[model samples]
Target: MILTTCAACAAPLAHDAPRCVRCHTRYCNKTCQHDHWRRGHKQMCKKIHRGGNAEQYHADKKYKEAVAVAVEACADDTNGEEDFSTLRAAINYMGSLIQLQRSEEAKALYRKTLPVARRVLGESHEMTLGMRTNYAMAFCADPAATLDDLREALTILEETARTARRVFGGAHPSTRNIEGGLRQARARFALRELLGQAVPGELAPPEPQLAAAATPFAAASAIAGHLGMDPQEANAAIEELSELKARDPEAFAELMQAALSGEGADAGDQDP
Candidate 1:
């Protein structure tokens, strides 16, 4: 939920806020956790540890469970109350979704909350900025993320990193986190450029020339005949992929994913 504030005492929590090992509760430190334990968590903690608290259980780790909880919580209308904790819960649940590799769902959550966050927290507020970070990072979650997607992510990170430095100072935790995100985005961008695979398009030329045959079977036979005739060339082409894998593992993996999706004929094309 925009973890700028501590979960226990409402104090500002830095980037490295300590968390309860068992339930993953964030705290400013041992004192806050201890105080919270005395307040009521002494029992709540036990319930979570014993798996009796479904909310706590869902909130901590499971992907599908977290999605269910977030969906249910978001369904509750706070009726435009700015201070409602349910909104925060929704935002935090998006983070959990992203953490668990449910990026598509996280993207949907960010799209919904980004406008609301801007209205409630203002554009430059920490919570809004955090959402921006989450939105940008979400684009990178899919294994089939395109070059355009990575570039879009990089653009958002670059702007977010710059604004974070200006508002929070370079040394601030938020600024540092954005900077790290920028680095990863850059790496993805570079990989896309360097690897430039060809994703197939609708306009792909006819397969080695089944183009001018009278019937489907004739074309199929012609192609089969050529396959027997040019077995060496086919073997060479297949080995090229292995060479690519040995040379650059990351790009090769990206290419493999794209190829498996039948996108290899025009993967090199970038989005406008």
Candidate 2:
């Protein structure tokens, strides 16, 4: 069976009438829909039609028409030079569409909306970055986000956090929040490092490879023996004690415990 009345205005509609590209509502004619959108229907377009009550009818009908028009205008590449307000309106409408479970339509809207957001808000503006963040999150929700994309986003976010810290302060909420996220991403990258540990030149051999790797006591004794100087130099004395600790596990444990216990000791009483 074919219906003939417009779903929106209830005016007579053709059976094969072209429908709203967004909400899929049939219209009597393009003129009726256009006037409804421009005059009164624009505000309610993001809503789904559920009832015929006077208020519901008006709100749903107008909003649907308005959204359809906005979506079309936004998607029209020919109108790529539209003003910021129009672009923002389209972005907002698309968000509403997404909430209505119109994911495909919302994605199309986002694609067009992002460029305008970048242009009108400027590359570094808060609004622009927010839009970019929203777009990234949307992509992340997809089952297809590759590890490479996440890595790239991690790098971008790290730079963004650094810029925020330089512009604001390290403690600023934006900088701190982004810094926290960057820290997590860094921890994830550390796993990659662990995997490549077996590769040559990756992990340096433990401290013996370091020139002064020996206990302070051994280093001091070696230096004293070579230089003919008293091992009374503070560094030399520390080296000598370090060697003592290395030769006796019990002595090293005692020293470590004492150091930790004195963590809050007064500066004047602190041991070098």
- Clashing residue pairs in candidate 2, if any? 41-62, 44-63, 45-63, 45-64, 216-239, 216-240, 217-239, 217-240, 217-243
The numbered model that scores best in TM-score is 1
Q: Against the true structure, what is each candidate's TM-score?
A: 0.49, 0.32
lDDT of 2 by residue, 103-207 (tens): 456667667767777767666665455444444433333323334544655676666676777777887776666666565444333322221321224322254
* Error at 69, model 2, angstroms: 11
Clash totals, every prediction: 12, 9
Which residue runs of candidate 1 sit more than 4 Å off their true CA positions?
1-81, 197-272
lDDT of 1 by residue, 116-200 (tens): 8889878777777888888887776555566688788889888888888888899999889888877766654553443344323
Clashes of 2: 9
